[model samples]
Target: MLSSINNIFGNSKKKKTDAIQSAVVAYSIRNGKLTVLNEVPEQSVKNVQAETNGLVLTQGFHKIGGSFFYFEEPGLYFFSFPFQKNSLRIVVGKDAIENALLISNTIIRGNKDDEQSLKHLKKEVLDRFLVLTCTYACIFVQHILNETGIKSRLVMTLTAEEENQYNDGHTLLEVYDTAIKKYVLVDIDKKCVFESDNGEKMDLLSFTGAIKNEAKIRIVSAAGFPKLDWAGFCAVDSGFNFQFIEQMFCYDEQQQLNLYKRICNLPVIMADNKYFSVSSATEVKNSWKNKLNFLPVEEFRQKFYPL
Candidate 1:
């Protein structure tokens, strides 16, 4: 996986050395009142005071770190003088966006075991962590495809009732491969593509079903995180079986292989050898659990426990 990821980015040219630089100042309106976050003294606004709520201009660029633009409706606005000389204008083109996303992935790369931080978190907070994990995964996968020079965007699984009644949805990455001139539907977590979706039996397998189901699905902006109540991750019956236990109970590759082998040797019944007995399921589960250093729900407490 690491080698494959390297091969993807290695193909792309390094970002340009001539980095654009500027300073930004923004004012937002919430609840019909203009407000500035910084507690600037009233006298500081003498030079740039806006007599009305039209637009404001600044004098020159100032030192600002990690340049980016962000705005939201009913609360935030990316305010700057459009025509003024030396004023901040967000220059986030496609290449810039791609670079930012790649940088984020690099930060998250060495921290796969970082789930330890969730230890002792309340169930409310743990739920939030799961939402964040999936959301970040969606963004990471989309950016990874973009960095590889493949055209892709995020998709949401929504039912007719969901569309009619609710405003929630699940995130999925859909990519367009120029070489094949076809679209590929991908679920990054399962690491598979859509094999079939008949509203009853949805198959998420790799490589096969994408070619037959090539259609121009409407894409939406990838902004906010997805919710747990969303269709894909909501219920096991929804056909997107999220393996929460598998993710929470992580194992290294060798440990996983060893567990598989051990379970195979047991007297557990098997369904075509792909399934195991539920009667001894507790024993099998506990065996793997013993290998981990700490419990999932009480990892922090484990540290203080007596030997």
Candidate 2:
């Protein structure tokens, strides 16, 4: 299903247009009514050539580069691939993310700390009355970027004190910046970044390696959080609150950060009919591990929980 969606939304020669719509990728196609993926805007798609099996076509179906068309016939058909990269630069990504965060701020209201809270968090998201949880924040952003062919994921942050019960736990996102061919960690909701000593924006794995080495990291934030509805969700709403975070982390004697969770694409964050396609947990975890390239000190021999 993912592959088929990717192919249909795949990039190819598109006709030039004076204006581009902030529409998302195709979501569901039941009874010939195409539902666009939620919020994940495809602003770059100027035109698309739709067909069936490279041969058959329905009446009013687009045969060439057409921005607007009609699907008059009804039946189930396959789609193309997903995650075809978009070439728009610098500000486009930031603007898209900020816009997404603003929307998330208004909807989801609170942060869901661990598995226990997720039970209720899931219900809140489906209802459109959002709670300010990092998990769902990433879910929203991941799909927004995913629909437009930008790669991203939902990752967890766990504390080394395994018995702490996730008091220090957090969740963040790792977005693949195709321009650099590297994944960068995003504070997601607040539009901030994790950086190393050299002032480079760090990916989750790289930051994990730095944390392993007892190195310091800088959390650079943008201006501020927009005035939104769910201002009460402190944990998520304080994304740019570096002082708050630093004060919280000041107690850590050895490490500046807690153990980072191996990438879990959030296989469980499902929606009946919205945006983002969930992938297998094993698949996302392995992909994250493979990206590690050079292995860190594997102290957790039995199970590699952290780097």
Candidate 3:
């Protein structure tokens, strides 16, 4: 079913309108209707294309986009792939999350320090949310640059601490700030990245370079996958390749509990429907290990848990 949806939605061609391509198109998907808001201040608001079943037809034309649709909407809906160079991605905010919570406290309801909690967390958050980590800490931040009405792409980078072998893997976003004419590094998970020319502060490469002691860099773009590619209760995209993620390691359930409790207070918030398609526990574990070496979940808990 997901494959069929992808087959239809994925069939995109080059659009002739540069205005639509570079414009910040506001979109919303509700009750199977996909609507696009493309209007100039003096111009009347018009829907360029309205597709049934909420599949985005304009993937290649626009590099940046926004959606007002709430993920908590209970129904089957197709999400356009985030693989395009200038594709628009949805933002997961607080209100939408809080609203979902009202419907079901089970969204994020569990103790942060138990293996059961981890399972519930995965079921509620990890499964739906992509867990992005950097070198120091896992922080979730949000920032919207209103500079040009057109949204910009954000690049989320992951660099290994040991060899500094990094995978640019995934477009956290590709933000084009033409007015500033400067590169901006956004912590997508944190949802906040201050726009500044201070190369030293927002410089992820510099920090990794200092640790790796190498000037040369190798990075891979980890583009987020569409809903079809993700493993879920109903559908599965077998062709979807799971990358970088490996088995999650722990001595026992106790350790797992500790780790969960440790990061519960951190800036991480598991939003709705942000689950990963890779539902395998082993895969998640391995991915966690690959990203952050087996520093014993217990160690983190011991370090951060209130004494």
Q: What is the Cα-based TM-score of model 1?
A: 0.24
**Clash number for every model?**
0, 18, 44
Q: When superposed on Cα atoms, how far off is each prediction in RMSD?
A: 21.6, 18.7, 19.3
Query: What C-alpha lDDT, on a 0 to 100 scale, does residue 107 get in candidate 3?
Result: 20
What do the candidate models score in CA lDDT, each in turn? 0.31, 0.41, 0.28
How do the residues 1-307 of candidate 3 rate in per-residue lDDT, one tens digit apiece? 9988776666543343433455443444433356654433323324433432211122222222333232233222232323322222332222322111111111211112122333243333311332333221121111212211333333333322222122222223333334454333333322323312333222232322232342322221111211111232121234333321211212333442232222221111112423212112332322333332222334433332223
Segments of candidate 3 deviating more than 4 angstroms: 1-160, 163-174, 195-307
Error (Å) of candidate 2 at residue 163 is 3.2
lDDT of 2 by residue, 1-307 (tens): 9987776555321321211332323332332254442321245333444443222233343422223333333322222222331210111233333333333332332443323343454443332344455666676656545555666666554333323322444567766665666667776544457788888878655565565466777755442433223334344444533334334433342222342322221211112322222222233333222222222234221122222
Ten-residue region with minimum lDDT total, candidate 2: 84-93
Clashes of 2: 18
lDDT (10s digit) by residue, model 1, range 1-307:
9998887776542332112223234554433355543323334333332222111112222122222222222232333422322221111223322222322222221112234332322222211222334345666545534544557655433211212221222344555544444444444433323323332212111111221234212211111222232323433234544445333322343442232222222211112323222112233333322222322323322321122
Which sequence of candidate numbers ranks them by lDDT, best first? 2, 1, 3
TM-score-based ranking: 2, 1, 3
Against the correct fold, how does model 2 do in TM-score? 0.40
